[model samples]
Target: MPEDVEDPMDYIRLHLLEKLQVLLTTAALLAVVYFGLGRWFRPADPLGPIALLPGGELGKLLGIVVVLLVLAAVAAAATTRSRPEGALMTALFGLGGVAMLSPPMQTLFWSYPASMQSLYLQMMAEVLIFAVGIMLAEGLGGLVRSFMAKICPRWLWTNTLSELSDQQRKTLKKSRIDPMWDKNILNGDSLSVSSGVRNTLLWNLLSLSLHGKNRTAAQKQVFRGQLHRGFGCLFSGVLAGIVLLVLLLQSPERGQILFALFGSFVLAALFAHHLFPVRTFFVAWMIPMLTAVLFYALAAISGTGNRPQYQVLPIDWLTGGAGGAILGFWLSGRWREIRIFEALAQAPPE
Candidate 1:
């Protein structure tokens, strides 16, 4: 027999065993990232809710068992021992560990008094479970990605704007003569249009230009043009004052709501690049900022509605006022220019 040749079935078995070992390693790494990052940044949080489980100790014991099982499985596949006594023993230990780590096993052992040993066991168990879960998910995700690559339509993921509707596609095409959308929004000293609609459209255009891939120089130019045209303020003072009031009175418990509100506005403003020819970045950003302020105000007035409240008055007002004033001035200037432009357009061109 050739030195390198092995039975086909045997080789297949070995490969499978090797794959499992690799999976074990991957699980270990992922658990570390998830738990370690969370701990380092925010120590107050107990290592994921999993750490709180009753069978925490058993989980750690099971992790050790899994390691042994993987080793034995690999050994059995590599060597031609009829009994494979050591392999089976290792496998048993691993399985025993798994059982200990299981939720049911932990529940059964709930009567065990808490101690340093118990705490260590729980932490270990949570880490093991997390690692294994992430490894399994990663393995499945790889399969999904491969399937998507093979099965998904190319047009759906491609960057070519020719796929859009005629109106949208026109914004994508290069033109010597500027479209009405571009001319109206982009011909200003500050590089933005005052109209909410125009700003919104420009924002979308920029986003499309940035989608899923790098933009060509031409695409970048288009994006820049739209950005310049769409950058302006809308309702200046009234919006500013309202925003300031809300920030001054926002409560801590409503942080999530505030975060969501601000996050959405920022995201919309960013996406305004995709909706070209409309100048809506300022307006889009304003939407979220306004929402955050309003949410804060509501939460404060309602006493966080069954949640703890944090005092944030002078600081909130100062920050909100500064931001609002800048935004207000820009919007007021843009609004004035837009009106003037409209008036000039109505008059006969000199």
Candidate 2:
């Protein structure tokens, strides 16, 4: 009866359309991640004969990855959508441009491709990674915050909260911290540790403080942008990276001896952020770590004598995992930070 109310058929139609949009977007993104990573790491099977670094295509694969990410960033600039959507849209177009330049996907569309058993199994494991990471980021982040507050020294929190710059104060306002409770964390209830929610606030404030304290003015500006971007936004980029990796392994051109060396990044949002950074990086390392373990376990379970002639050895995985995870986490975080700054910079100055 009112202008605000919609007809039932109209609602059904719109809901269907929305579902269709999600379906198309998911497929497109799945294509982009799968094809992009496949083409990049063509030379190294990680599970097959090609191998990874030290003896394989790790360096070359990595070099190409940096180039493609830059390409992705450039492509993202062309998208009018918001941050995460822009990133995905960029990947879609970036994959197209890549395919045009190199139609190497022919061999992959082989009529009789290698057995997908290993890859499928790997995919299952990856699904686990995403399930754990995506589902837990909110809960685990809060939990870890509480855990940190419960264990961390009161002095550290007091010191961090005590010297809140105007920007820091604004950040709290932006985060919607309760004024009264914020005051408690800052100056009240000195002896009693804050409850979980309050402790969560303390941990985030502490994160902001720790990350921004020694930064240069420009860097601090970026850090403030990161604070505004918030951990969830930063984690979205991390989510995109892991999603890319998960899709990477599902390519039609596959062998059991597989490695998504290109997409290896902080699998961290799965467990936890920046200490936080380290924890996040550790999770990123899980991409490769899980890949390595899953394959080895699969091999053992199958009792296959066709052991992989790994060019990328365990050491390569460990070091690559460490570097890639940390770097990926930092880069994704930085991208979100810069993007937030770009948006904020356009607003009328305070």
Candidate 3:
């Protein structure tokens, strides 16, 4: 007789419903901000020329995006009833909606008179552009994966998971530990372990409870390896940002707060990785994420040329370092791998 399996789908459905409620609540809050507070802080009179592409069109675009998002959520719920990935998709849709609506948030901060319908229209247009940009980003990720699979079939999971030969299966069975069949695609690269450690570190930082190890000394090695690998990742971000800045060199009133916030996120993540060599959930995921959010807020404040914003960036850095350590430690426990935090925590006290 087959063993009874507990359905994860039921839990997923419940979570999806909860997320939908949260989204609806957020939408209600936005509506209040747009209608209530926006009336009091009206900005300058409409002095700009109206383009052939009107603002109402932008609002219509947002409505279209909302419809598409709803469809995605429905498809995710229907297809992934029993899968955790399905629930994750639902969350992604909810987050995407929030990002799409963020451009219009500034309108709530200030009031506009009836004469400045053009200003409101311009705001709506900007919101649509921003939403489209974010959507493009999400689409680009999928496009890259598609291209990778087509050009490097062996590296893609599609080919990696092909039916195994009898000899291959027998060889795999002989090993005491489970073999990573995907490793074959890497052609025995020496950096594979380091790469795995780097990827694991990011995941661990996000959720300290992901599958990990118990040994402390080994975990420390993994942390060091991840740090080494992260150097490349860090530089890549800086390089990409610099390149974008260079290409779009116009001083179009770029918000200091945005840069500061992003900078703080990077700083915090780096700090967390270096400090708090403890393997617990609280330290890794919670600290880093909180630090990132705080950094963003501080950067926003700093962009206004407010002096207090400078101090918060340093705090963000420290929190990030703490988060990294906590994440490293927790990852060690989850993956049964060596991480720096685990090693330090397990060290003999003097």
Q: TM-score per candidate, in order?
A: 0.23, 0.29, 0.27
Which candidate wins on TM-score? 2
What is the full ranking by lDDT, best candidate first?
Answer: 2, 1, 3
Candidate whose lDDT is highest: 2
Model 1 regions more than 4 Å off: 1-36, 43-156, 163-224, 233-249, 254-350
Question: Candidate 3 — worst ten consecutive residues by lDDT sum?
Answer: 188-197
> Candidate 2 lDDT, tens digit per residue, 1-350?
11221333432343343334434543554466456654564454323322223123446434433444443343323221212222322332333322222222222214214643443344334334322332223233334334544665331122112333455445444543333223322322121222233323334456666765676765565444434334443455355544545555454232211234334444433222331322122234344455555554554356332433222233333333333443354354433333323333333446
- lDDT, candidate 3, 69-171, per-residue tens: 4433342233221121222223233332222222212332243333234443443344344334324322332333345446654432221112334433333
Candidate 1, after superposition: displacement of residue 296 in Å?
A: 16
Query: Candidate 1: what lDDT?
Result: 0.32
**lDDT values of the candidates?**
0.32, 0.36, 0.32
Stretches of candidate 2 above 4 Å error? 1-259, 264-280, 305-312, 343-350
lDDT of 1 at 32: 42
For candidate 3, the TM-score is 0.27
lDDT of 1 at 281: 30
